[model samples]
Target: MNDTREDMANRVFLISGGTSGVGKAIATGLARLGAKVVIISRSADRGQAAVKEISEATGNSRVDWFAADLSLQSSIQEVANIYKRKYDQLHVLINASGAVYFKKELTAEGIDRMFAVNVLSHYLLTNRLLDILQESGPARVITVSGHPRFLKNPVINFDDIQMEYQYSAMRAISQSLFARTLFAFELANRLEGTGVTSNAFHPGRVKSNLGRNAPWYLRVATPLVNAFFKAECGIGVYLASAQEIEYANGMFFDEKKRIIAIHTQFEDGAGNRLWTLCEKLTSD
Candidate 1:
């Protein structure tokens, strides 16, 4: 932790979805350690609020914000371009931006809203910033993933990648999470020996605004569930600052510690397919 803290000072971090929830916590923790934090958000008002809160809370005025609709590839590319123009290097890139839709819908881009926000945005943004991350050497990429028990096989439906044919609240959320996990692992594989490490984690059921899209009953139950089972921002602090897992790549964690994903398919050949699909989707 000491080493991580010492190394973090003066370094740059770009965190998507840092406006609230676990992402906000991580941004605040890193800023306290003296890192130059750049938070990307869809709304300027929310972004400014988060930047002010983080700066005041940590007493680190280096915190800044970028506004972009991550659900759109063009917006993500623009944000990346702005980041590159402002900062010469990025020491860490945290893909913490995610969302769940109570009902199936498509974005203005004609892509499923869930897939666009939860999976595609991270995919496009990470790839766009890969060069600077590699140039920064010893950089880290941490993705916030979810843990959902599924009743059916969690395979990518190439025929209808965005759940256009069939959709349910749970199924839509599950699909995006599965895609995110695969992208994290696939990213690790591609970044091997590049001094860039990629990993994903389940932030452990925090009482965050990520669930605002849930039904009325569940939204009402959020406080109770969090009271009994939610985890603190400490786990996020550990993952970002702990020295032991600095070199750890292609791994999935429950919280602070590394844990194996029960299904072997998570590490199987599915990643290649997903990667290929992502490449095709994001290609010009």
Candidate 2:
């Protein structure tokens, strides 16, 4: 992967949810390659700790962080503004922040917490930074998605997008995952001729604290499940740094780096619908 590192060095990568779990793993991997990795965190103390940990682990001091609550659109926009004000170039953006809520909840912005963090956050953050990505040219936007096998019959309930009527954690998480993938593909379609590309990938069953908000029993079992899964995010790192797929767009990749087809259902203009909905929801 020397070539990957060579390409990554001196480049800028901004990652959400980089303070821990899959985001942290990818951030560490990128930092080790000498890339300027900036992570977003909801807590400043946690963000600083993660930056220190990544820097110490990778021996790369360019790793830094910005604090932003992914559940809030205002916070995301503010962080994007901060990033643009502080940095001039952005080579890659990894939308790795995710959340799983057992009960239905809404943010101060009146958005479903899971939908806000998992889908809209990716949408707004990427859209906010699109201009910079285009200026940077040959850049990429990689979104984290669920395993394709688990999303066999992916369908988005546009009418109940917020899960207002009946809320099940499984249903909420699945819909968010599907919507995020759809957003990635739609983004690619919109960015067809632009120098920037958009794609999504499943980082495999890596150890993560996504279940931290679950019930106590589930929280207690998270470590055991995580112990049985791989921890390193090689696929995320590969997708972000590999030069071969620099122009790859609207693709879904597995942990093995193989491209998976977008579900045919998504081609029915669902992406555009989702995009429009996000536009309305996140609009000022």
Candidate 3:
């Protein structure tokens, strides 16, 4: 599973949230492999700084960045258009942008902040770029998921999807995780013969700014939690560049690259329901 510069040279990878956390780590890894890496960030200044840092750190000038607010469908569409116009090929698309909001809020589009970011954004962005992905045949769509243990009994309450009645930060976060994973699986099934594979993986407990919007206590505890769990980008890099799993789709892999069986709950039409819901939420 070793990727050489020669093997990765000129290969294109587009990563959402590439300015931080697992996204930045994977972007760096890909850049180091000699691939053309494009990352999406919400802030122009931060995106430029990240591009410079990753380029300098990896010594790969091919690293680049684009600014976009993933929580907004219009923003995602605009960025995707810009990306397609600038790049002719997209070898890999990594949906790694995520966040935790201590307070329940809605985006301008009237979607829950957490769900819009963690779930709908992935759906819209990926679908918007599907043509390019298929054109770049043998491409991959790698999504970021939480720990398998937390997802063992995944549930999506379509009735109260926005948690309009009773909203806890944890409930919102959990629902987003489940919905995104379902989207990944459902995407794989739909792209079965398109030569574009889709899979989800846990990036482990990576040291990240995921808790930046959380309560003071949780934000304060982030550093301590990160001290014990480092950002592990091996699986992300592997899934993006691995020759073995080039066609692996509808699968879930752990941080160690072990394929875990998808829970039966996900197979019972939930993926379809989630996909339909996303289609409605993100409809132009």
Lowest lDDT block of 10, candidate 2: 1-10
State the lDDT of candidate 1 residue by residue for 1-284, as single tens digits. 23236677868988898898878888888888878899998898999999998888888888999999998888999999999998999988988888878988888887888898988898999999999999987888988877634413576776677877778777677778788887888889889999999888877666578668888987888777667654346556666666798898888777646576633666367788888888887783
- Cα lDDT of all candidates, in order? 0.81, 0.91, 0.89
Candidate 3: residue pairs that collide: none
Which ranking of candidates, highest lDDT first?
A: 2, 3, 1
What does the lDDT read for residue 141 in candidate 1? 90
Candidate numbers sorted by TM-score from highest down = 2, 3, 1
lDDT of 2 by residue, 180-253 (tens): 99999999999999999999999988889988888898899998998998767999999999889988989999
Name model 1 segments beyond 4 Å from true: 1-4, 148-153, 226-231, 261-263
- Candidate 2 regions exceeding 4 Å error are 1-4
Per-model root-mean-square deviation over C-alphas: 2.6, 1.6, 1.7
CA lDDT, candidate 3, residue 249: 92
> What TM-score, over all chains together, does every model reach?
0.91, 0.97, 0.96
Clashes of each: 0, 0, 0
Clashes of 2: 0
Candidate 1: pairs in clash: none
